[model samples]
Target: MSGLAKRLAGQTAIYGVSSIVGRVLNFLLTPLYTGRFAPAAFGIITGLFAYMSFLNVVFTYGMETTYLRFANRPGTNRRDLYNRVLTLLLLSSFGLTALLIALAPTLMRLLGIPPGSERYAVWLTLILGLDAVAAIPFARLRLENKAVKFASIRMANIVLNVGLNLFFLVLCPDVLAGKYLSGLAPLLRPLYNPSIGVGYVFLSNLAASAFTLLLLGRELLDFRPRLQVTYLGPLWRYAYPIMLMGLAGMVNETLDRVLLARWLPEGFYPGRSSLAAVGIYGACYKLAILMSLVIQAFKYAAEPFFFAQSEDKNSPRTFALVLKWFTISCTILFVAVSVNIDLIAPRFLTSPEYLEGLPVVPVLLLANLFLGVYYNLSVWFKLTDKTYFGTYISFGGAALTIALNFALIPVLGYMGSAIATLVCYVTMAVVCWLLGERHFPVPYPMSRLLLWLLAAVAVVAGSWALPPLGSWIAHMVHLLITLAFVAAVWLVERPERAFRRTQAKAA
Candidate 1:
């Protein structure tokens, strides 16, 4: 790998330490939640979070990307830019948060939250505000290449989030019930409210977001709350399109969950309420986190790295190589997880009820793979200052996602939602690449990437065709298949050989 690629990889590794570990810790909560809450109840968590995803986009309004874009420019005053972005975000976050909190009752009714649980809306809104306030500081960390500090704060937040979840959802309830530690029940009685039930999940998240902001004290303290119109005008123009794109992108990414309960016809799953179906889909969706985790870590590193390298003459080749390797890495994850999901699902789900949604996992994983590619391809527009294209493409994808969900959910149940996600992302990635070729023209090895993707899918399909065997034997067979796929990939994409060829050409 070249120095630029190595730098990107190293940064990704640092970010991955926090992202992978933090997300894995968060991911571990799946079993805790599934064990504690029924599918119907878990669906409430799923649906609320899907809405928060959209709200989060609106809260920050894409200032994070705008900060990176402007801060990296020649003669730019990074400090001033950071302060302006942070100030704008803080102002907007507070205003939006108050609006949401004041409208909590109406929001609750619209979201189908049971009456008297307005706390859920309030807590989620607070979480969004806190996270939005912290967004610029987090982006500044990336801009400064402070990956270690970034990872540390992220890890701390996840640790606290997980710890509090266990405390509120497990220890407090168990102590109050006299299940164990009866002596501590009196001490915990003030904190333990059984009536709150799943509201604790949102409460835990709220506390964690606040803690993350606190840990970013140094970054926040550096702010002077400046808002120069010269900067703000351009920043607004650059960022609003990104915000629109992000909102529409969230529609593609999460609208399925938000719409599933309402759109799924009655009696579709027999004995399963629409919420129960959403819960099942949500649980299975977690199985795709490995793919997303890789993409996220890549994104953290790639965004800043791509902006920094935009001036380089060789950037297009570098970008193409990066995408090639990124696809390879995700393809490996897709196969590894899909083939062993039988073993993995049971361990994480604990409840047999959720296993029914297992079939959606591979489809979701593949969708995320395409989403990652879209993220990579999107560099062209960001670098070219043509972000309006992103807005257009994302809104187009969102329309497709909504149309497909409406058309498919009633017929195929939650599986329809999964299929819709896959189709939407695939379409967005292809459309972005086609537009990019005309405008930016990176030599992405489309044929090879597609071949690898198809091969991985075939491997997963072939794994399903294997005859039933003992649990241990089946695991062995799947392990061999995974290993074989990895070996084949290594042989074909030998980095050392490519590096030597590049050196020879240079010589």
Candidate 2:
């Protein structure tokens, strides 16, 4: 194999394993959380995280991508570049953390969350800040090909977060209130607040972020930072469009939660059902995020690799091939989830009310499939430094997302948000493709891509047409059928046959 291809495969495995394992492990928490916490409580969790997503982009100042671009530039002083970036990140993170803490109460009130809940906001602030500082170092790990360590740190954080959650939610509250504490001090028993559910979730995240900081201590201390204006000038220019894209991208992905809370009038659902419905939507969305998981893992390597190896003749062809395989994998996942959601949703969430959001899962899943394709298509602008064009597309998507959610939420509630998301992602993907071809055309296999998509939609229709054999048994049969359909596509696509022929010729 070629060196680039080999590196891509190895790094992809490391990052993919970390993502898949982390997501699967974290997926276990969905059942526990949805079972225990009220919908409003989950909404609180959802809203806070959505808020953090935007803040993270702000806190990092797009330095991660900036680091990748500058660090790979010819004749660049790698050590100086790394140091300056880290130094700037440290200063910026501290400022952002403090700023958030100071503004926490007002911000909470503005978001329609209660005021005394400043503590949750504070936890989120610290976590985001810590994450921002760790961003480039993490990217550095990817750039330096330290995938093992990269994956290791990510797994460790997930483990710590999950452990802390189980302790606070399951073990601590009961143990502290039980015979042991009761015997020691009856008054102390009253102090145990089992009602402190979502707050504890934030606390767990904070503890995990702190632990991650300590674990990355070696990487943190080793890089000695110094700013150079000449390097940063062009670096900032490259990153500005990325920052806009990141900000707009976050808005498209996340602004719905914020808008839903603000736009939807009270009494949308029965007895705070709006919040609960949002939580349900959030959980179901995770099921669809399988596409996102793969895209994320590929992106970590693909972005830097694309930029660094820009001039190579094989780069565009390789991207085209990756895009095709990405669609195929996502198409398989789409069919599996659309067909077997009845089987999976029960394991992932507890309440029957939560299951109402199941229909949204397939819609959101297909949209994300297109979103991943758009990400692959997005390399054109980045490689050519025409990132502003990408930013414009994301902005258009974000505006559509917000406007649709606003107009429809009062009428449709949580489902409106899902529809808006689906529309926005599809729009972004289509627009990116049209504009991208004009700038830097890659040979995407349109016929194969459409075939996979059409086959997935057909499987969805087939699964739906089959009689409901009582939910459980019906779902099982549908899952098997879905797998059969995917296998059929794999046979027709003939990927393995093509691979063997290429190898034989090379030999």
Candidate 3:
């Protein structure tokens, strides 16, 4: 790898420590949740969180990207830019939180949530506000290459969240019911309310977000609340398109969960309720986190890295190489996990009820892989100040997602939603690449990328076609299949040869 790629990889690893590892820890909570709550009950958590994802996009409003973009410009005052961006974010977050809280009951009713469940909406609103306030500080860390501090803070928050979850969901309940720790019942009784139930999840998240904000105190020390029109005008112009893009992106990403329960016809699944389908879908969706986390870590590192390298004449080739490697890595992960999901799902899901949704795993994995590609392809627009194209592409994807989900969810259930996700992301990536070539062309290895992707799909299909075998033998076979695919990729790419060629060209 080149020095730039090495730096990007190193930064991705640091961010991955928090994103991939921390979220894996967070993802563990799924089994706990699934084991404890029935599918219908868990669906409430799924539905509320899906809405939270959309609200989060609205609350942050693209300032994170805007901050990174403007802060890197020559002659710009980083501190001043941080202060203005953060101040605006804080002000808007507060305003949005208050509005959401006031309308929580009405919103809950519209979403078909039970009447008393408005507290979930209120708590989610607070969480959104806190996270939005902390976003620019987090972005500032990325801009300054403070990956260690960023990772540390994020990991701490995840640990605290997970720890609190165990305390509330397991220990407290077990003690209250005298299952264990009987001696501590008196100590915990007043603090732990059994009626709160899944509300603990929201509380745990809110506390973690608050703690993260506090830990970032130093980043917030210079907040002087500057809102000059001179600064605000350009920032608004640049950010609003990205915000629209994000809003639409969230629609493609989360609206399925939000809509599945409402759109599915009664008795579509025979024994299962629509909410149960949502819960099953949500649990299975966690299986896709491996791909999503990789994409997130890459985005965290690559956004700043891309901006910094924008002036380099060789950056187009560098971008092309990044996408190639990114696709290769994700395809490997997709095949590995999809092929072994039978072994993996039971460990994480812990509930037999969720097994039905397993078919969605590979589809969602491929979808997220495409989403990652779209993120990489998106660099052209971000660098060229044509972010409006992103807005257009994302909205188009959102339309397709909504339409597909509505048309298919009634007939196919959660699998429909998964298929919709795959189609939407694939469409977005293709459209972005097409538009990117016309404006800011990069010589992406389109044929090579498709080759790897098709190869992975074929491997997965072949694994499924194999005759049943003993558990150990099946494991061995899957391992060999994965390894063979990796070896084939290495032999064909001969990355060492490519590296030497790149070096000679640079020299």
Q: Which ten residues in a row have the lowest lDDT in candidate 1?
A: 497-506
* Model 2 C-alpha RMSD to native: 2.8
Evaluate model 2: give its lDDT: 0.81
In candidate 3, which residue pairs get closer than 3 Å at backbone N, Cα or C atoms, i.e. clash?
Answer: none
Assess every candidate by TM-score. 0.98, 0.93, 0.98
Expressed as tens digits, the lDDT of each residue in 449-500 for candidate 2 is 8877987888887787887698668967986898798779768767677467
Say which prediction, candidate 2 or candidate 3, comes out ahead on TM-score.
3
lDDT of candidate 1 vs native? 0.93
For model 3 the TM-score comes to: 0.98
Judged by lDDT, which candidate is best? 1
* Displacement of the residue 79 alpha carbon in candidate 2, Å: 1.4
**Where does model 1 exceed 4 Å of error?**
501-507
Error of 1 at 489 (Å): 0.8
Which candidate would rank higher by lDDT, 1 or 3? 1
Residue-level lDDT tens digits of model 3 in 165-224? 999999999998999879999999999988888899999999999999999999888677
- Models sorted by TM-score, best on top: 1, 3, 2
Worst 10 contiguous positions by lDDT, candidate 2:
179-188
